[model samples]
Target: MLSRKEIVSILLLLTAMICILNAALFCNIMPIATSYEQLAQQTINAGTAYICILYALSTWVYHSNYSEPRRQIRYVLIAMLILLIAANLAGLVTVVKTLFMSDLSEAMDMRDLFSSFGYLCRTVAAVLFVITLLLLIIILIIVTITACNHSWSISSRQDSKEDLP
Candidate 1:
């Protein structure tokens, strides 16, 4: 049976895989872009999807590690994961709509709207990813400082013992 952490890690991995798969499907099924704007939107969506994958995997690694972070930090990470999944789902829906679009002219006319939506979703995901990374860095710094202090105290105690008459 999997532990809670293992379960969470599996879920994260699955979510990441799903995001990447959706992006792959988009790439495979999408018609060649008739305009630069359309190409840019496609590139951004694909890029953001890959970034989401990276974020999910990194978070999973952190969750799997033995060094437990604070409960609040873990909660924050979970919340971010949920938000990222939501954004990816929205992107998936946008991709589907684009794929089944009936008229090339209609797609072109709506290119600006699609591009804006893509930018918004990507920005949200990127911001969350950066925030998560920052939190990880802060945790690492705290852990390093704590370890250094612990080792210093131990060494100081040893020195005092050697000095005892």
Candidate 2:
């Protein structure tokens, strides 16, 4: 069985990886903004990136805290992630809505690819954001329960030892 510290460390590392991926997606993978449509797309990309990074960092710091009954801490972390995901997604949706109805009169012709790409990118980002948030919650619950059970078992053993000759 993994020690409490080991379990906690693994969770933290996972959280860090999540954050790093988000930051990379935003800073590296996202395209540069030009027109309103591209700008909207880039904004969603950046927002989702920031959201994931914050969620991971927050979960790492929040759960498995110094105190026991880590459930409270886990719940808080989950709530934060939920709010972040919701807010970022809302922004992405707004950007997409605007992009879809953007003033494309300047175009000498109409093409589906240019304006709608942002929608697809943001949509993918939104889905990934949800997945990461859910995974964080699952990880937190698993680790917290394991640590709490370990703590209880150790305490029980100490009680038995103290009562002996």
Candidate 3:
């Protein structure tokens, strides 16, 4: 049961964190002057992006109610819940790859594979994946603010009306 102010403030802070983390992700993953190992490190170290979303969702649930929006909130919550699960699934993939398909992970020698088309394709795929992850962060921030503010503003008006009577 967060006070309305607390909810707004928390959401704002989460939005800021999302923006910063996304910038870091983009900076590290994009085809810059950085080494290939730096890009790999960025991918492997991208845990904070998902964790922030999970915590923000948890905060929303604690503060939100069914009266917030009978239909839209349900749909939105379901979608975010799915995303949280998917993020965990992705993390599991990271762990599995670490244990099984990690031959080149140590050597990172793409000299042989770099000449192959598949390696280039895979690198592009990973870069796009990180871009999508950043997009999700922005989406969550927007959805949270729009939904919460709509309900909060309406409630404020009703409070004023009740006070007048």
Residue 12, candidate 1: alpha-carbon lDDT: 47
The TM-score measured for candidate 1 stands at 0.40
lDDT of 1 by residue, 1-165 (tens): 974444544544554454344334433332455434334434544554565456446544555434234344454554554554445444444444553443674646645544555545444444433433343344334434555565577688889999999
Q: Model 1: clashing residue pairs? A: none
lDDT of each: 0.47, 0.51, 0.49
lDDT of 2 at 83: 57
User: How much is 115 displaced in model 1, in angstroms?
Assistant: 23
Q: Which model, 1 or 3, shows the larger lDDT?
A: 3
Put down candidate 2 lDDT per residue, 6-34, tens digits, no spaces: 45455545655553454345323334443
TM-score of each: 0.40, 0.42, 0.42
Candidate 3 Cα outliers beyond 4 Å, as residue runs:
1-71, 74-115
Model 3 Cα lDDT, one tens digit per residue, 47-129 = 43444455555554655456554336534653663574366346335433533366885677534534445354444444544
Ranking of candidates on lDDT, top first: 2, 3, 1
Worst 10 residues of 3 by lDDT: 91-100
